[model samples]
Target: MKFAAFSGVFIAHSIQEAMKLTQKLGMDGIEIAAREPHLSPTTSAPRIKGIKALAADLGLEIPVLAGYMGGFSTASDQECEQAFDDFNRLLDMGGELGSSMIRVAPGGPNAFLAHDYHYAKAAHWLNKCAEAAQEYQIKLVLEIHNQSLVETVDSSLKLLHLIEHDHVGMIHDAGNMYITETDYGRDSIVNLGKHLFHVHVKDEIRVAEVGAPGTFLNLTHRGEEGFLQSRLGEGAADHQPMFDALKEVGYNGWITLECHAPYPAYERLAHDFQIVKKMLSWEHA
Candidate 1:
């Protein structure tokens, strides 16, 4: 498998600067984030063309588009239509940039009524999106995030089975699934092996109590406390086993480093990239 970097963690800088950093870090490619303060659908074609040209000039390829942030659950018909419009635009841009996969999180905080309802909604919308994506021959991979409906492996499998679309798959995020109280971490990957299209590598640690033995206080609200982000090999995530598992499954997809730690952007990303390179044994191509 190849190694890349997700630009989402580099939210502090412009996309152009992120591209430059990706090249400098000796990565094969990048996963662009198509959201505000990063990259948006409204970003002009010429600007995107400039990015493509730069990548080519630097011998880099964009294998994935990381941030298509519209969720289906809370969306009205109009909102869904707008999301569709935005998705199509992203697909067009990905085609222009020569990216084969696009990453999306199924639904955000407002999307889930309950687990089952969220799955049903996500399955329906993903199938529709998959049909739309087929026009450009792009694959839509859902990243497993906390607030997303497909947060666990079983849920992800259910959505995959329900959608039953070849273009739809999972993007396993090691850190996103790592909660202090639960073994949600490894299950997400183990359950969705063959269906995994991409991987986002990071680490997390929890220190607060949240009533349950394995449950951590929800850090988002002030009521919760004690959550920390660490570099690869520094936190709870045992990435080597994950790497070995991917190798066993013959997953030749991009393993992108997502440095969400609270360090300076450039330093953290560069360090994470090097650490991942060593773990993956990536060589110049």
Candidate 2:
């Protein structure tokens, strides 16, 4: 599997700076966060072209664009349309950026309020987006996140089944899955099978200790839990089993380092890269 650093972790840095830092950290690519202070819907073609050229020059791949577009579960049709419109723009940008995939949220009213109808609505809109994404030769991947309808593996598979498009798939966000206390590791990855389009690796721990520096609380459908983001392998979420499962599944897609631990972005990314390199048995030049 190839490795990448999520640019969302480098929000404080310029796009160029993020890209450079990613390359310097010995990553194979950079997953550009397609939002503010980075590349947004309003970002021009010239800027997109320049970003692509720079990535190429730096020997980096632009594997995926992490977009902030999603309202597929909202109560209004107009809101869904607007979200789709923004997603369409992101697809156009992805085409110019030469990215193969883009990350999408399933929908949110949180997991508790989201019902089967919300899931169906999200699938309908996602299928529509899949059609649009085909034009740009990009794959739309739904992130398995807690605040959304696709929080668990079963729910995510249900949405994928409803969408029924080969161009759409799932991002196995291990950290979020851990936070939600959902099924993960070999079982989840094997279940995802071909639908596991991409992966995000971060580490998290329960706030049993109470006084951790970066401790925060997350209230989800599964109830409330105090959590802290930690460096990979140093946290409660062990990724070795997940990596083994990816190998078993022959998943050669991008694995993005999306650590949100409170630390300097460069240092965090660099430290995480070493761990990932070891995990994947990847060697540098």
Candidate 3:
């Protein structure tokens, strides 16, 4: 698996500076967040070209352009239509940035959002995205995230199988289990199988002692975001089994670090970079 870092974690750093840091740290690639202060859909054409040039200059591949296309599944028809339009803009951005895989969410509203109709609507949106992305040669990677219609292996596959579009794929996020309490089934990687197009790696432990499900998901601060802490083997998420499952499936793809490591982003990001590199090596060895 190729090692890439998501630029979102370095929110304080400029996209160019973050790419410099990523390259200096010896990462193979980066998953550029197609958001503000990064490479939003509204980013200028020259800036997009500069980004592609920068990646090439640093020998870093931009595999995934992760975006926040949330709440489409459970939204009204108008909202879903707007979400699809937003996804098209992201796909256009991805094409300009020289990246093919763009990350999106099968967002749903409210708890108990899981339903056949929800799955079908989400699939319809994906199909629209796939149809639109064909011109850009981009693939819309649906991430396993909470409040999403296809938030688990079972739910995700149930939705994807209905689309029959190759441009629609999956991203397995192990850290997501902290939110989706029942996300892990018998064998997630085995279940994901061929359709597993990408992966996001992050380690998180419970913030509160004996925390309930979705307990750690709450923010301690305004922009606290996700993850209490992150280290490879020492964290709450068990990655070895996940990697072993990848091996079993012969899956060789981009395993990105959506870095959420604490203060001194450089230190934590650099440390986890090596940790993931070692993890991938050991897994393949």
Best-performing candidate as measured by lDDT = 2
Q: TM-score for every candidate vs. truth?
A: 0.86, 0.94, 0.87
Model 1 spans with C-alpha error above 4 angstroms: 108-113, 180-190, 209-225, 281-285
User: Which of the two candidates, 1 or 3, achieves a greater lDDT against the reference?
Assistant: 3
The true-structure Cα RMSD of candidate 1 reads 4.4
Residue 198 in candidate 2, Cα distance off native in Å: 0.3
**What is the C-alpha local distance difference test score of candidate 1?**
0.73
Q: TM-score for candidate 1, please give it.
A: 0.86
**Deviation (Å) of 24 in candidate 1:** 0.9
For model 3, the local distance difference test gives: 0.74
**What tens digits encode model 1's per-residue C-alpha lDDT throughout 154-220?**
6567668888688898888777766423234345456676788888888877755444432343433
Cα deviation at 212, candidate 2, in Å, is 6.6
Q: Go through the candidates in order and give each one's C-alpha lDDT.
A: 0.73, 0.85, 0.74
lDDT of 1 at 179: 43
Best candidate, TM-score: 2
- Of the two candidates 1 and 2, the one with more favorable TM-score, higher being better, is 2
Which candidate, 1 or 2, would have the higher lDDT against the true structure? 2
Query: Across residues 1-285, which tens digit of lDDT does each residue of candidate 3 receive?
Result: 787888987778999999998887778988988787997767888888898898999999998889887466777888878777888877877876778798877776422446777777777777878888889888888887655665578877787888868778888888765455544432888878777899888777656442443234533212234446555555677776787777777888888876565547677777776676565576532
Cα misplacement distance, residue 130 of candidate 3 (Å): 0.8
Clashing pairs in 3: none
